[model samples]
Target: MRAFDPFGWLEKYFSANTLHLLIRAVAVVVILAFLIHRISLYSRYLFKPLWAAETLIFVIFLISYIIRINPADRSRGVREILIPLAGAMLPFALIFSPSQNLITGQTNYAYIVFIWMTVSTALTVWGLWTLRRSFSITVEARELVTGGPYRFIRHPVYLGEMLSAAAVTIFRFSPVNVLILFLFVAIQLFRSKMEEEKLGHVLPGYIDFAAKAFWFWPGPPKHQR
Candidate 1:
């Protein structure tokens, strides 16, 4: 049996490198379809401040998947694969539960929400631009990206995601949404641990980078010893 590298767990069953890639293309197609639906739905709100910036983040995501280079290695186990899939799909699940407003939905709350989204979207796009071809949804060892927002945070993308996701969760507050948000953040943090473990094993410099960089919080970039 051949492994589908892109889907990660499928690699448990499939075997060829090219087969991995072809399946990866299929995975990208699925992501592209989902994101396109999101982009269209959100574009209707383009008149909102920096709304297009948020939309472009999706564009970057699709492009990153399309242009990403092959990983040096990736974990093929089902556990490693499913953790990320859960994080990716968690938000979509929120569509089912009715959205309960967290606050009075005042103009002040609106401004605060928009600000979080704007900042988070900027951070995400910055990390994405830096990560670009090195990006992967699954736990894969690729090039060590140590520049840009990565200088300060070990996982700027995850932080940005956390913030943006938090903002969304706040707006769509509900018991189910809260649980989903908690799991999403917890999974992201755990995924960071998995990534660091993989990178420390596979890339020589990452261990050193991890030491100086904050996990998700902002901090000064790594400096000379």
Candidate 2:
């Protein structure tokens, strides 16, 4: 009946209006498409990378919203959107789950979530923007992304997106939300394997980059040193 708003849940932790839902939505779609392009050769998974389960879930959410919002279909609905809503909300909405009052009751935690959301969103925007010209969503991915945040981090945007979602989970403090994040992490790891194969075959510098860069997460392990 109500839309899930993660930023609203974290309003206590940081000032309101830090996260822009509309822009963030656009960013998600763009990034998903970009990542999907890397694994386009797979062909069976709707050109979806193995790690794009979150994007798939969001796409389903978009479809559900379309069904709910269409005035003509509203009356002839096959099923209420409750189940899909719960699945979608479980990832980020749990921060305000049970009730928003319970979360706002702890202003400090709320503030922390808000701040994390704000910082993560800012990094996402900046990182994505830095690669704007180099960004692509077609089958042909970038040759290399060493210019911007990519120089320091192979997956800065992914990290930022994960952080933003994590902030939402912290605000909600739901076990189910943590589970979804874990699922996402697993998907990203799988996608990394597929991407490395693609890059090694097509892109020139990828192997060297992989040698230096951490796959999904950042930072080299002690053993690497």
Best by TM-score: 1
Name the runs in model 1 displaced over 4 angstroms.
1-15, 46-50, 97-105, 216-225
Q: By TM-score, how accurate is candidate 2? A: 0.50
Instruction: List TM-score per model, in order.
Output: 0.81, 0.50
| Clash-forming residue pairs, model 2 | 12-111, 13-110, 13-111, 51-187, 94-172, 95-171, 95-172
Q: What tens-digit string does per-residue lDDT give for candidate 1 at 1-225?
A: 224334445556765576657856886787788777766676456236557666667778778877877788665664467778789778677657654454434667767777887888789889988998888776778888999999988999889888888877776777878888889999988888777767777776776777788775332223321
Local accuracy by lDDT, each model: 0.74, 0.49
Give the best candidate by lDDT.
1
Worst 10 residues of 2 by lDDT: 70-79
Model 2 C-alpha lDDT versus the unseen true structure: 0.49
CA lDDT, candidate 1, residue 225: 19
